[model samples]
Target: MNYRLKLIVSFALLISLAFGIGGTLLISSSYYSLLGEEESAIINEYETLQNNLMMINHFSSASSAQNMQELIDQMVERNMAHWQALSIKSSGETILESGDQSLILNYVNSTKEGTYSYVHINEGSSRRLLLYSKMSTKNDVLDLRASFDLSTSYKQWKSQLRMFWAIYVMVVILGVAVAILFANILTKRLQSLTNATKEIAGGNLSMRTGLRTDDEFEQLSRDFDIMADQLQENIQQLKEDVQRKENFMGAVAHELKTPLTSIIGYADLMRQGGLDEGDRLTAANYIYSEGQRLEKLSHKILDLLLMEKDTFTLRKISMRSFMEQILTTTYPLARKKNVNLVVSSDDVYIFIEPDLAKSLLYNLIDNAIKATPEGGNVKVIARGIKGGCEFDISDTGCGMENKELAKITEAFYRVDKSRSRAQGGAGLGLTLCKRIVDLHNGNMVFTSKPGSGSRVVVQLFGNMSQEVDYEK
Candidate 1:
């Protein structure tokens, strides 16, 4: 059965069992107690009647059975108003009798002389307590019988039993009702939780059992809500991961197709054998340049992949020396592009994986040099901060809009697509740079206006750092 019904039935059965047992015991005890009192009262009356008869025999000058019988008759006559029935017998012959003779006869002869006995009798609609005893007189021994009316006590007992059962039934029904209400209140909370679970299973992750009873149910609901939040967050993360992978694959195909198509067309021209030496040389140069672009693309893609799969160790390195190393490598590129490369830094030792850190700084400085116009300045600055260091790279080049800054670190996301392609940029440099920054437990922020220059800030925390030792 359902829980509510089960609770009601259980409560009702328990109440009925308890009340039936207790009430029956109480009524039965009360009836028997009243019956006992009646029995005692009748026995006392019989003793009193017997004593009066013996006293009469003692006082009178009587020696015959007839005189004894006359004394017994006098006693019976005096006490008949208090007794239901009375009988006096001598030698099995009835001498005096009052009240129901049949009832008296039934009990009078059954008891032996010199022995006393009392019993309860149910005769038709009446009840009685009968006492039979033998009284000795001077002339003879008399057999005496007396009875008490118990019809009223028996009738009251039956009435009480009926009334008790009636009240017992009502109280049990009331208890069952209360049990149903209590069960409903408890199960309602369970129902709410069940519904929420079903909704979440059906893909509605936002559902919640907003119970506020301040009991275990409330605590359970709070925990359930927290679990739902975590589940939704994990599912969202999975979806974003899938989308990024799809975009990455599509960008790789497009980048490879452009270089491969051009190389195939120029090689086909060389194969046809119809061009002069000058034209053939030009086509070969175009092929070589495109091949170099493809090589750069492959290296950038490998760096991005390795950044995700590999772990690195960090060592203390001088920031000034590190910046100078990066300047030396990119100085040729800056000069080739006719752009000024400037570096300024506080001498500080910071912890980093040297190769990965160099790759990160090189990509940023290279991008700055490429973006700057001829004779325009590309500035690099480094400083020591508490627990770490920061690098700021700014370029007076063709800066992009504020909206473009957010996607600049995304793979293959270039602000000026045609300009980027013309400069042989596969657009993965900032993407690789972002990944490297994340590996070092750092953050990168970019700010640029359309006409003004763009500034990129890199902050590395969770790294050991100290001011450079000039003495050393």
Candidate 2:
């Protein structure tokens, strides 16, 4: 059975059993107590009758059956309303009898003297309490028998039993109705939880059991909501991770295909043996340049993959020397691009993984130089802050729009795809730089306007800086 029905049935059965037993006991006890009182009164009356008969036999001075008969008649007439019958018998012969003689016959004979015996009897529609005794008379031993009407007491008992059952049935019915209502309320909460579970299983992760019973069920509902929230969050994260992986793979394939196609076409031209020496040299140079670009792309992709899975050690490095080295290395490129390079720093020791840190600065500087027009400025500045260091790389190049700045750190995302490809950019530079910043427990912020130059800010924290020792 369903839980609601089971609860109802269980409660109903218990109530009925308990009430039936209690009511039956109460009514039966009351009836029996009343009957007992009536029986005591009847016994008292029988004893009084016997005492009066003995007084007549002792004081009347009559030793004859006729005298006894007359005295018994007078006593019978005196209390005719109390008894159904009264009879006097001696030597197997009845000397005096009044009222129903059949009542006397129904009673078993008691011959022993000085002891009275009583019994209850049902005859037809009437009930009787029979009392019998043998008493010593003036001239003979007399057996006296009497029957008292107990029909009223029996009727009262029957009426009480019927009334009690009627009341008991009503109480049981009301109790069952209350039980059903209570069970429905309890099971309603459980039903809501069950429905929520089904909805979540069916891909509705936002389902919740909104119960507020101020009890254990409420606590359970809260816990269930928490579990659902966690599950939805984990599932969303998995989906995002999967989509990212797919995008990365597609970008990798596209990058490889371009280089491979160009290299193959040039090699096929060389193998055909129809081109002049200059044309052949041109094909070879094109093949070599594409090969170099492919090599750079492969290295950048490998670095990104390794960064995801590998841990690096950090060591203290002098910021002044680090910036000088970066400027010197990128000076050739900046000169070739005809872009001005400016540098500034605070002479502080900063913790970094040296090679990765250099790579990070190189990518940022290279992108800045490439984005800048001829005679435009690319500036790099580093300063020590509280417990850390910050680097600001700003370019007076053809900067980017706000929209492009938002997606610049996504893999293979380029602001100007043709210009980027012509400049031999695979669009992984900022993606790789972002990953490096994340590894250092740093934050990267990009602010740009369409015409105005863009600025990239890198803030590295967590044991990032100390004062340089000039005395040493």
Candidate 3:
């Protein structure tokens, strides 16, 4: 059904087929070998029986012919139960006296010179062993044969075959199970990787194949996760850069238009040819003021453009004084909105890029001030954590929902884009902060509840000299 299952089943079927073929070959060879051994044993036994029978004839010839039949019978009986003596009239082919009269008559009737010395004694019995000879001093001769049935060897071979097949089946079953088990384990790992890849292809970068074993599948899983993580980060960065460029363009246009509009209005008034000297001077001053606004907008645009690039470094700075300086700079903006901006920190010295770090804190505090209603509160807090520092910016503002917070870090994603722009931001402020933190090997966490408030926490690991390899 699946790739993994296909591989597993294919392997299992191969083993089963191989076992069956090998077992059939072994059984066939062994059966024939057993049969050959049985035939050889019977042949050897018959040859020995013929030799013993010839010896009996010698004994009978040496004895007296007075009670010839009696003497032969007595001697044959003493020799063995299966052998018996007999007297025969060879010319008429009749038995005169014999311990086995019917058998002697049958042999005499069937005998002819130059016939087989050993052969089957009966028409219906192929297993019979026969030895016939002409009489030494009489026309009568002696005949002897030993016959056997194959019932015993047949039973033994059947028993052996049954045992062999039983063991064969058991061994084959175990072999098949082992093959299937290994195949399934390997295939199952591959299946997980395939499914995870599909999810990743569909833009679900969080999907991962969590393999427990140390093998090719595990290596593949690690590679896939690393690839997905890199891809996710690259896509995020590209989106942010593109959005920042767009927003920078828009803000510059708007900012330039405002100043240019005022400048053009003042110039037009002066060019009307009827203005007083004082009024003309007033228009020049207004144009100058508008032109300065253009300068301010240009500076902000430059800052936004730089934020789209990668530059993460640290400069030795006091964490407490840094927070104080940011507050001093942004306090006027907070006062304009009637919002209380509070700053607190655990005293610590941090090595950080002051410009970028200041930009980060400024954006957070500024956003909080704008979002907070009149008389509302915005707080900036910093602390020294284990091996790192923690910065938190919180506001009693119209917060965000879970769905909005989830994608808040995504570029160009703003709950209030127009309001954010009017507040003198490119909306790349938080996104830039996140990138700078990432470059510093740090993390950003956003916690928010609609209508309640929002808190943004930034955790930046200390630039400590240690054996910890970030790549690992």
Candidate 4:
């Protein structure tokens, strides 16, 4: 069933049931009240007749039936016309009477001694109340009866019943109306949510319910929107990751294919025979160089893959001692290239895996040396800063523009591809450096321009205690 109709029907039935019971009770109560009022009036009449008869017994000396009848007529005449009939019966005979004989007989027969009784009679077009009482008068006992016209009270009860039924129906109608209004509002909100979900299912991922109702439904809508946003973001991230992997695979294939082709071609030429010593030497050299390049590329690729699985144990190392060791290690290459190497530092320390940290520093320094020309300078500086240490490796090498700098850390990405290949670079150096720094929860920043020297700053977050403080 439609929810709105269900709500309306439920509400109407409930109201109708409640009002039906109440109306029935009300009609019964009104009927009983009319009966009670009629009874009270009859009792008052009986009391008056009893008192008047007692007075007549004390003062009047007539003593004959005629005198008694005359006295009863006067008494009856003095009373108001609240009843339709009055009667007095003695010795199985009615001495004086008015109104229906049958109704009075029934009332008297059914009446108990020393008590009053009443009966309702419907005589054609009118209803009547017959009241009977037995009383002792002077020397004889008499049955007195009266009939009250009840058509007015009956009409009143009918009117009251009609009014109650009307009210009950109105109450049910109003309840149904309110229920439909409430149901429509509720169903409208639910429909909005349903529509939004359908839109999302149809691939409109950005769809949302902008419901602002201050209720649970509104909160639910907000939560749904948040879930959709997160879902969209996660999907986009997954797509980018897949694209990156595809690009990485393609680059790896191309890099490997070049060296393998050169090595295979030259080796095939050497094996073809009849080559001179000079030609054989040149071919052999070319094959060896390409083989070395392929070897280096394989090791770098292995390092990249292993970095994903490797866990590191970190220890604190003094920045001054670490820098001195770095300088000692790279001095040979610096001297070979005739590039001046320098170091300056303040007391600082970093917490990192020694091997990974060494690799990171070595890669940066080697790249700096390769980029710097003969007679140019390369400076390594370490400094203590609040909560951490920083290292800057600046070189008077050919710097990269912004476009190249942005992708400098991507695998197999190089600004000067020819120069990088000639220097035996598979372009994984900065990528590895970045990974190591990330493993240590550090950051790297590069400042470079096309003509100016590039400065690579590495920030490691850790203790930066001074040497004197460390000793203490």
TM-score of each: 0.76, 0.75, 0.47, 0.84
Q: Which one is best on TM-score?
A: 4
| Maximum-lDDT candidate | 2
TM-score of 3: 0.47
lDDT of 4 by residue, 1-472 (tens): 9876787788778878888997889798979898679667767876776556556644556554566566666766876446677777777777777666665655445555567776778877578877777766656667777777778777788788888888887888898888889888988998898999999999898899989999999999999899989988998899998998899899999999988888888889888998999999999998888889889889888887898997656666777887788888999999999999998878666565667777888999999999999989999988877766778999998888987888999989998999999998998899999988887678999989877789999987643222332310
Instruction: Give lDDT tens digits, candidate 3, residues 178-275.
Output: 76787778777877888988998898988877787887778888888888889889998999978867865675576567668878988998888799
Ranking by TM-score: 4, 1, 2, 3
Candidate closer to the true structure by lDDT (higher is better), 1 or 4: 1
Q: How far out, in Å, is residue 101 in model 2?
A: 4.2
The stretch of ten residues in a row with the least summed lDDT in candidate 4 is 463-472
Looking at model 2, report the run of 10 residues with the lowest lDDT sum: 463-472
List ranges where model 3 is wrong by over 4 Å. 1-20, 60-248, 268-274, 318-348, 357-472
Candidates 3 and 4: which is better by TM-score?
Answer: 4
Q: Between candidates 1 and 4, name the one with more favorable TM-score.
A: 4
Clashes (backbone N, CA, C under 3 Å), per candidate, total 0, 0, 1, 0
The 0-to-1 C-alpha lDDT of every candidate, in the order given, reads: 0.83, 0.86, 0.67, 0.80
- In model 1, the Cα lDDT at residue 472 comes to 15
- Model 1 TM-score is 0.76
Q: Over the stretch 321-354, how does candidate 2's per-residue lDDT look in tens digits? A: 8889899999999999899999999998877777
The global Cα lDDT (0 to 1) of model 2 is 0.86
